[model samples]
Target chain A: MRMDLDKQLNGSVQKAFLLLEAFTLDKPEWGVSELARSLGANKSTIYRLLATLEKLGVLQQNRRSEKYRLGLKLFELGHRVSIHQAVVHCTHPVLEEVARAIAETVHLAILEGTHIRYLDKVESPQGLKISTEIGSLRPAHCTGLGKMLLACADSEQQQAVLDATPLFAQTANTIVSAAALRRELAEIRERSFALDREEYEIGLICVAVPIFNQQGDLVAGLSASGPANRFREEALPHYVSILKRGAEKIREGIGNFQL
Target chain B: MRMDLDKQLNGSVQKAFLLLEAFTLDKPEWGVSELARSLGANKSTIYRLLATLEKLGVLQQNRRSEKYRLGLKLFELGHRVSIHQAVVHCTHPVLEEVARAIAETVHLAILEGTHIRYLDKVESPQGLKISTEIGSLRPAHCTGLGKMLLACADSEQQQAVLDATPLFAQTANTIVSAAALRRELAEIRERSFALDREEYEIGLICVAVPIFNQQGDLVAGLSASGPANRFREEALPHYVSILKRGAEKIREGIGNFQL
Candidate 1:
């Protein structure tokens, strides 16, 4: 029989993907019924798909919570793609130079789903350390990288992402409303940089500039961050200049394909 | 008819995932027929899966090559996992301390599939620079973390992996024979550390010690590397001591958090 490809795909495989897609940063762990409800699929169908995915190491069931979260296999696959390498390769030397010049923690990040995932970071030499994890996902709208990315994205895509994700009040300084976020993004675009003024966490402020690829596309961001007290508004211009220079250096390095 | 749970998977999703999985680091790009043969699925089924995955940004087709490879979305997802953060959170201070003491590049890496994926690196202020990217992946059997992980893995798993993968000689010093690799792993196990003597790359010698979780399971490895000429065997004991101490510090920071 001649295979009708479209007809064959309506079978088991597609259902499994939908089940996997039902998971999000906020809802990293999900029960079987919760997944079924989110995917709009039947409970039994979700069960089978989850079981298969679990076996493949695409998902892991928390024995205590009976909830499924994304598994390490995704990370294993990501390592092969070298995405983190791309970012770190592009920004590490620049970050080190920036950190040495400014003596503060420098960060490189990119938008991933609804959060900003830190790709690289250089810590300062002082006793006060700014801690940020490389693979950690933090709410993008409230982060310097997130705002920079949102500022660069088209209006429709920006709106779609913001609409889909909830804006939690991480700190009193966070922008909660769509109107406020839109305004902030506009301001960020004009300045060619963004600042996290204790938006995501108290006492931590980050200043970031966008990184463009050879195509002049906004690919990632580079930032200099430290305690809010240390990076006060008076010190803003210095941080912004260092960060912009670092971003430019990274862009040049990216264009040149330097390791 | 009663629903057969296995049969209820949306076939399109399964086919799409299988198609995506078909592309590997060795063959990052593949044509339709190659994908079909690898998946043991039909051409038409493969085509639809590729199309859907491409549309969702999970796969990309190189217009010139007409071959498919894993897309930026995987990187996006990996960025969400923040594995780098886990490394940074656990090792940043330790690396800083080590860099201050040793004056060399210190790196942290974990086994990702068949390669060692670098997650964090700290550069020394006054030495010959050997910059390693955070997301770079290198063959596990020849590098410091790779040999450490191999030593940690069960004999059966190690043999199975070695048998399945072709051992490519990256440098003249690299161990290409299974027997030699087995012997190296035995020594690493006894010493509680691994050494890379210009094995994976020329002019580089690395000494690494495994970091464990609270449960005493090997979680990752910490390594201090420098130019082979400068980092002679005379300094091996010092490097090993520093690496072990750094690994212990990281293990303490991580405690028991598996995530």
Candidate 2:
């Protein structure tokens, strides 16, 4: 069945992507044989694909290890994606401003399927107090940015996402139940802000606000995160105001853009 | 020749990359017919390729234009590159610190082929005074980062680069002769710093220093750029000190890593 699989499909490009998908942040490098075993493909086919990718510079082999990793060419092309040039370019400066004002790590993220993917970040001056990486994903039910984005989405989309995602709890503070999350989303929509009180990580806390484009469609979520001890209840209003200002600046800069 | 080309090559993956290569920043959007014409491929083949890529989230079609553009999946994969995770991760904060201290735009770049590719940047608080984008390439003969990197590379590599690259002038101050460039690079090596002197653009100037790993191998070049009017000769020592400190910080963090 697996042998017919390669022949049955209009293959080449699809096979290439499947190979690339095997490389991830958790396991960035792979030997040809390991990759072949993992993908359920023949070794010679995998070797040829790896050679082609390395030749194109989409992947590179470490001379010492002979293991392949994603290369700089993808980095170049990734930055060329129009959405990056059009959206992240404008929002990055604003993220910086918010990070400076809050003296905490700031993030711009959007919900993709059931996860929130960080699009950009400006780390705190005091050092990287947060572990979030650009282009990395976190579960939607526990992050402040995720809640803010999910809260602003239309009911149908929210329901679809909720139905699709399992809503597993990461910490005691996470609102894992669909009914509880629905109430929190409703409250977030009314308040125009969202907060994560040690939900995703034990000592991390975040506050977020929705960013909207000209059509009033929610474009992304802007958030400032810091250690739980530093997150004072009195500072909530200040954080919300600062995030809202940054969001408004982004909205003004990005014209009628969507994710 | 073109028809036979596909059969001659063990194609699929190569064809997909050739197709992806056409979606550059200068022309991010492409219609099926135009892409087919540009790449000298059959329309049906191009159409099928685009369809496959779109299905795999490698490309997205603009609703209004029906043209294809590189998608977020590429962005997601690009950021996972170990170079970005290992190198830029340490250098970006340092770039930000240098920009804050100097009150000018700062860059971290390295030689890729015969060109200098920007790896990270922090814009001046005054605004984006430098137009350099992260992951973008610029001629290695005109900018301060370029000269600094070239001056530090091995003699054989330097000669290979000089022999390969055409020393075309960008601004009137650009050194168009190989002999003149060699002299400048020698001076840069002797002085331990490099200056752009408005070589790349009429009104811009930059100062740069090389970063070395624990092994003392040249890693990257760190530079701060600003308008010529804002650049003062009296502040040269201060700028150099700041950039050197940032470069040292990067050097300590990267250990034995090379480009």
Candidate 3:
């Protein structure tokens, strides 16, 4: 078939990209032998691919360890992409203000297919800061920001995303059943906000409100997160009100940019 | 030679990555026909590679315009790399403090190959703000941060880098000569700081001091930048002292992280 021929032709390029994707926050650097074993490819082939990548400046090897890592070229490309994202740029000042006022970690994220891509974040100067990195992706079924964005999807699109995504429980409080998630999403839509009371991670609480653009479509979610002890159930109303105000300010900013 | 055969084999993969690298801050999106003509490749080949990249989530197609742009997955990867960079993470607070105190834009950067990679940046809250994105790369021959970092490299390393890089004149004040650059680097080494008197950009002045790790190796550069008119010559000593103190704080933070 034509599809089969196309796959065969693109196989080498795909494999090369797979090597780049193998590096992660947890396992950033990789030795040739280890990468070869993990990828189930011949050592010589991996070496050639890595060498070609290094020559292109898409990968770099440590001078002392000889282990390879993602090169600075990717950073250059990604930063350009970030600068162009209106959702990220428009929310930077608002996120900073919200974090400063509330003294909590604030985030701006958008749903990318079945995951949430964090566009920007501002951490509290308070000593117990959370270690969430911008550009990190998280499952769409477990986090407050993810659910807020998901709740905005149309029924057909929501069904398609739900069907394609595996609803893996990230924590004990995570909603694992399709029926349960649908009900929760419906409630979130009715309430115009979403909450994660230790759903994604224990001892953490978060509340998020959907950010809308000029056309009033969901563009991103503005979230405020902190330790559960400080983020008490009694304070939910106050936090949600602040988040809604912040979301309005972000929407105005987005409108001002005509984005 | 073996190198010739390797290049031949890796030709398709190289083409695929070239497309990825083609996206930039100015030309963030490209149509298939435009890309094909630019790369001098067949339309079918470019389309196939773009499709593969889209499927891998490293590139995305605009729904309305149908132009291709870098995807969120690349942002995820790059953000992870930024989080892992001790120079970037450790200097965030210091950069914010410096920017707030001096009422100027603060930047932290490291040398990447022949260029300087901006790891982090904080803008002055005042009405006049400089536009510099993190993860952006600039020529080392023009920036004060770049010169400070180049000053730390040994003669052979400096010569190797200089040989590979073209001394493109970014501004009228830029140094374009190898001998002149060598002399400038020597002075920077002796002074323990570098100054950019509108070399990189007209009407902008910058001062940078080197940042070192626990092992005392040059790891990064901390810079304070502002409009030339506001950054007076007599106040240079005071600005330098504040930046040095901030750099020491960052050094302590990096030491605490055991990075």
- What does TM-score give for chain A of every model? 0.69, 0.91, 0.90
Residues A54-127, candidate 2, lDDT per residue (tens digit)?
A: 87789999999999999888888788877678888888888989998999999998887777988888889886
Error of 2 at A126 (Å): 6.2
Categorize the docking of model 2.
Answer: medium
DockQ of 1: 0.30
Q: Which candidate tops lDDT?
A: 2
Candidate 3 chain B: worst-modelled 10 consecutive residues by lDDT: B1-10
Pick by lDDT: 1 or 2, better one: 2
lDDT of 3 by residue, A1-259 (tens): 0112345347667787778878877799999999999988888888888887877767888889999988877766677673345567667878888888788999988887677878888887787777677887788788999888889977775785578545787889988778888999999999999998788899888899998876787778899988888876787888788888888898887874422
lDDT of 1 at B142: 83
> Candidate 1, residues B1-259: lDDT per residue as tens digits?
1112245544344445555566666678888887777766677767767776665556777888898777656665554454544556557778879988888888878776678877767886764887565556688988988999879876775876588545778899988888888888899999988999899889988888888888888788888888888876777888888878887777888887553
TM for every model, in the order presented, reads 0.67, 0.88, 0.90
Best by DockQ: 2
Worst 10 residues of 1 chain B by lDDT: B1-10
DockQ for the candidates, in order: 0.30, 0.54, 0.49
Please state the CAPRI-style docking class of candidate 3. Answer: acceptable
Model 3 has an lDDT value of: 0.80
